[model samples]
Target: MALYRIADINVEYEPRFDMLRERSKKYLIGPSDKVNFKISIKNDDPSKPGDNNSGLSDAECEYIAVGSSFYKGLISFNGLLLHASAVAYENEAYLFSAPCGTGKSTHTSIWQKHFGKDKAVIINDDKPAIRLVNGIPYVYGTPFSGQFDISENISVKLKAITFLHRSDINTIKPMDGSKAIYSFLNQTIKPSEPELKLKAYKTLDTILNSVPVFEMGCNMDEEAAEVAYKAMKEGICNED
Candidate 1:
């Protein structure tokens, strides 16, 4: 068994694959007598079959399994996984969320280019954790950060969440409360258990009430980043 800290939570789990161990090396810590949770995956877990069907090796399968378990466990601590690209700029985090192939990472890369590398850092390219701490929503990086494995073990105060869509011209607008909730829910994991699902909903409610939500239609251009940053950060909608 190994101990690692993620999103300010100490977790103890035995990684049976080298890839998982390597991917999680940065989060490792000295043996701890106390842990927030522990995860143990048996060889015959149901995930193996689904992963195999998806053409992933045993090693890759284990990585997915571990991530799923961790995110599910995070719900108890007022945290849940958000399928988004999280970037930190000037000590604040901005999350761009969307369905797969929607260019979430591409949009954030534009931000890096527009703001300069020194100002923008991709904390988690995928699957970042959002937790409510003392009534503040924060985004955290985890090891299971998509195919590229681009992530840092850091947490930043969340400023806003923007849902992305493809468009010929860059435009953004504030999302309505009902629309925001639906868009946000589609991007996060929904636990199957009754109690955990309720907790997840409550946590999401706190986040929605505390953070701003926007819908941005953008193309892959530096101007896209500029438009989004201006509207989200300064509340200046150029198109309006």
Candidate 2:
């Protein structure tokens, strides 16, 4: 097993499965650490990549891609995943999730720009880990980064989770815990097994009880960041 380290967390990719080298190299966000993770990538359709040696069945490859992180215990899918961006600042973590192309990155960038880039960093732009510690929800950074080359092993106690939507101006509204659970589940990519679903529900319940959930609607501008930050401070500071 080859090892890679980032932000002090160790990752290990077992046995050096050479067959997956090309795809793994292309998608690798960081180096392997002590934690064992197996990642596999396959063409969406066999005809697309057009390679004879890519013998993986579509389903198996898909499972490896989505389920590998949890298998290694690097992240807890809880049968849910989110297409979101997260960042940490002032001892707090914020998550902005939405369907693809709905500005998760842009929203994160706005905050980084406002807070000074060095002081703000994205935890995960594609898939971040959500788990509970001592009954408090927290978000962790995973190597499964997306368009943003901003993955490092990092975690923060979750301050809030805000589902993103477009608006003419900035607005932040409190989310009902029950409704928040559904939105949170919808953001997850896949949850094939029943155990994962049960785990996810438990995680969501922990989150609802521990942190504030909100709906964040804003224009595609920096003002959106300001609005969210201020609202989060008001909403979660006391809870913390």
Candidate 3:
């Protein structure tokens, strides 16, 4: 078994699976002071690019198994892996989540453009981790970033969560508590256990209470970002 540092936590891989090394290369550490996650995959064959294997069919299943385990472990420790695009702007993390092909990435790109190419950056395009650190939620970029492979081994203070949907014109509105809770449960790495479910929702409730959530309806354009950001900033700074 080899220990790997992933998502700002120590992970020990059982059976010494090396295929995931590429994704975790930057996280390889000299020695782990602790183990936050564990995975055993010697029996599974991971896919490699251009390799004459059964494509990603087998790899995809393995990924799901590993991912599920990691998610459960994370949630057990007040952390959550959200299915969203996390971007850092003005030293705060903003998340955008939506259904497949709903242009989640496109929306954040506009944010990057609005904040200036150098000022704003996508920390993780998918599967970023949100963990409660000393009562404050922080978002971390993980290795499981989606195909575009856009991610960095970094963490940022989370400011808000935004649910994106396609609409004719750009609009942003504060989400209701019930709607915010459900939307978070639907979009995050959900845990099936009864106790875990309760803890997840409680943590979410606290987060939504402090950090404003918004449902952003907009088209695929730069103005969408401007409108959304303006609404969110004003709302957050002015909230009681």
Ranking 1 against 2 by TM-score, winner: 1
Q: Which stretches in model 3 have alpha-carbon errors above 4 Å?
A: 14-19, 42-55, 236-240
lDDT digits (tens) for residues 23-83 of candidate 3? 6666667775688767766453443231454555445445445655666777767788788
After superposition on all C-alphas, the RMSD of every candidate to the true structure, in Å, is 1.2, 6.2, 4.2
Which lDDT values do the candidates have, in the order given?
0.91, 0.64, 0.75
Which candidate do you rate higher for lDDT, 2 or 3?
Answer: 3
- For residue 147, model 2's alpha carbon misses the true position, in angstroms, by 2.7
TM-score, structure 2 vs. true = 0.72
Error of 1 at 115 (Å): 1.1
Clash count per candidate: 0, 8, 0
Among these predictions, the greatest TM-score belongs to 1
Task: Tell me, by lDDT, which candidate is best.
Answer: 1
